[model samples]
Target: MPFIDLKTQYKALQPKIQRRINQVLEHGQYIMGPEVKELEEKLAAYTGAKYCITVASGTEALLISLMALGIKTGDEIITTPFTFVATAEVIVLLGAIPVFVDVEPDTGNIDAKLIEAAITPRTKAIMPVSLYGQPADMDEINAIAARHGNIPVIEDAAQSFGAEYKGKKSCNLSTIGCTSFFPSKPLGCYGDGGAIFTNDDAIALACKEIRVHGQSQRYVHTRIGVGGRMDTLQCAIVLAKLDRFDHEVEQRLLIGQRYNKILGEAGVTTIVQRSDRTSIFGQYTVRVQDRTNLQKYLNECGVPTAVHYPVPLDEQPAYRDLCKAGHTPASKKIAGEVMSLPMSPDLTIDDQDKICAALLAGIKQ
Candidate 1:
């Protein structure tokens, strides 16, 4: 089975997608077009955020948020090590330090209890990644940030656009939240697209300007910025997808829970989803001993598998010397054991059962 069934999704939404694309093409306002505003407004309403600034990519969204916050050289940003490198890459790109924290073994999300201890006077922000589409312990992280001089918290919600925490959407749970619309993501467009969400008016304004090279008005450069605008075509595609997004999210939840239940009955160690929050299951991963062999076996059984992350960012060559990382035993251990299975809203129960049977058989071998 295809890992992420985007083909099936596209087929289902073909008419709407074609119609949206046709409208954009006919208008020829490709850059900063009306569709862009329409997407931002709809996304903001969906997330319950005051503003949503669409950017070229998720990395750009994080970078722009840091710029709006005025992250400077030598400023420290606390984050978990067990996530996509983009989380720390953005920090290091702006000459800021990413202080590494351990993650919870169950969720692979930052350990909120350890966040406060990582804080120092130089700590300007706390960035928590919503790994595998489950939001980090946001309320606890926010409380810690509030206690520590109201340090801004940015939720790296690249995999969690449709997820919810404490009844609040993933991208609106913190001071600033960023999410990706990469083709494989839960609420993805056809290509690279991302958005920043926040209730802070000043930060929102700054992000808007920054996405267009810091333009306050036509040709007026107000601050140093990057060309990070998401094109109108991408926005149009996302707008069309939005029509079926709620149903897709529900499908993802049901499929994820099914995986959890079937795997649990067989005594498999899969990622845990807390009761207080919902995971969109960008990757329904499981922990296994001899992961390499298990993956090989599953592949042989026609079950595709992938790893969300195999190496901790702290252990990477580029980041080892750049970021300040203390002992993260949990991150280190989970890095080797975690393996993601095929996950998508369109994944079928028959395919899921075959995958689980293959996995259970592989584990016994």
Candidate 2:
């Protein structure tokens, strides 16, 4: 089975997508066109955020948010090490230090309890990644940030655009929320795109300026910035995809539940979602013993599987010195054990059954 069934999704939305693309082509305002603003408005309304600024990519969203928050060189940003490199890469790109924190073994998200201890006088922000389409504990993380001089909290929600935590959406839960529109993400565009959401007016204005080479107006360079505008074509594509986003979210939830049920019957450990949270099932991963052997057996049985991450960021050569010795043991352990199965809104139950059967047989062997 295809890992992410974008082909099926496209077929279902082909008419709408084609219509939107035709409109964009007729308008011919490729950069920051009408569709760009249309998408921002729709996303802001969907997430209940006061503002949404579309950008070039998820990486740019994080960088722009940090710049808006005034995260400077030598600033310390507390974050977990159990995520994709982009999580830490953005911080380092700004010459800021990423204070490595361990994650909970069950959820594979940053442990909120350890956040306060990592805070120093130089700590400017707390960035928590919503890994595998499940949001981190924003309530607890926000509380910690509030106690410590109201440090800004940025939720790296690249994997969790449609996820919910308590009564709030993932991208509306923190001071700044950033999400990716990589083609494989839960809510994705045709190509590279991302957005930053915020309720604070000042920060929102700052992000708008930062996205366009620090220009408050045309030829009025207000501050240093980058050309991080999301293309109109991508915005049109996302708008087309948005037609069935809610339905897609429901399908993802149903598929996730089915995976949990089937995997549970086979005595496999699936990723756990908390009672107050709802995951979008971006990966539908599980922890298995002898993961390499399990993957090999499944592959032989015509079941495809992949790893979300194979090494903790701290263990990566680029950031080895950033992590304290013997830190982030849980992240390292999970890296070796976690395996992702095929997941998508269009994934069929029959395919799921075949995948589960292969997994069970592989384990038995």
Candidate 3:
């Protein structure tokens, strides 16, 4: 079985995809085309955010958001260490210190209760990642940020574009939200693309300016920026994918629930999704003992498996000295045991059953 099953999804949407691509080709305005604005508008409305700024990639989305907030040298941005390095990388790129915090053992999300203690006078932002397509305790995290001089909370929703937190969309739940379109994400484009979302008008304007070489007008340099605009072709592709994104979200939920039930019945340890939130299950992950042997067994049985992260950011060679230390025992522990199975909206039930059975049987050995 394919790890992500993007081929199946593409096959289903071939016609619409071709049409969208054709439109982009005919327009020939590849940089900032009409499709870019159309997709941005649609996505902003979908997330219920007042503004959306499409960027070159998810990493750029985070980097540009920080630039908009004026993060600088010596600024401390508190975040969990248990996510993809991009979360902390963007913070450190600006000469800012990434204050690593522990995550919840069950959900593998940052522990909001532990955030306030990590804050200091230099703390500029609180960036919490929505890991494995499920949103973290955004409401609690936002409340914590509000108490501490109203620090800007950035939700790294790279894995959770279609997710929800207490009726609010993932990208619309915090002071600013960023999501990726790296083909494997819940809602992705053919290539690299991403977006920044915020309700704050000034922040939105700053992001807009910062994404295009800080141009307030044509050839008018207002601030330092990067080459971060999302290609019009990518935007067109995402717009086409948006047509069936709702159905895809529903299917992912059903598949994820089924995986939970089957694995739970067999005594497997899976991550928890809080009742108040909904996940898109970007990667259906589970914790297992002796993960190496189990992964070998599953692969032998035609099942593919991958680890979301084998090492926490703080433990990484590049980030160890750059990030501030904290008591993050949970991040280290979870990194060793967690493994992601094949997950896509198009994943078949038969495939899921076989994968789970193989995992269960592998555990016995």
**Please, what is the whole-model Cα lDDT of each candidate in the order they appear?**
0.95, 0.93, 0.95
Name model 2 segments beyond 4 Å from true.
Answer: 322-326
Cα lDDT tens digits for candidate 1, 133-177? 999999999999999899999999999999999899999999999
Report clashes for each candidate as comma-separated counts. 0, 0, 0
Residues 265-340, candidate 3: write the lDDT tens digits.
Answer: 8889999999999988999999998999889989899999999999999999999999998899999999999999
Q: Kindly list the per-residue Cα lDDT of model 2 for residues 19-96, writing each as its tens digit.
A: 999999998999999999999999999999999999999999999999898888889999988998998898888889
Cα RMSDs, all models: 0.6, 1.0, 0.6
Taking all chains together, each candidate's TM-score versus the true structure is: 0.99, 0.98, 0.99
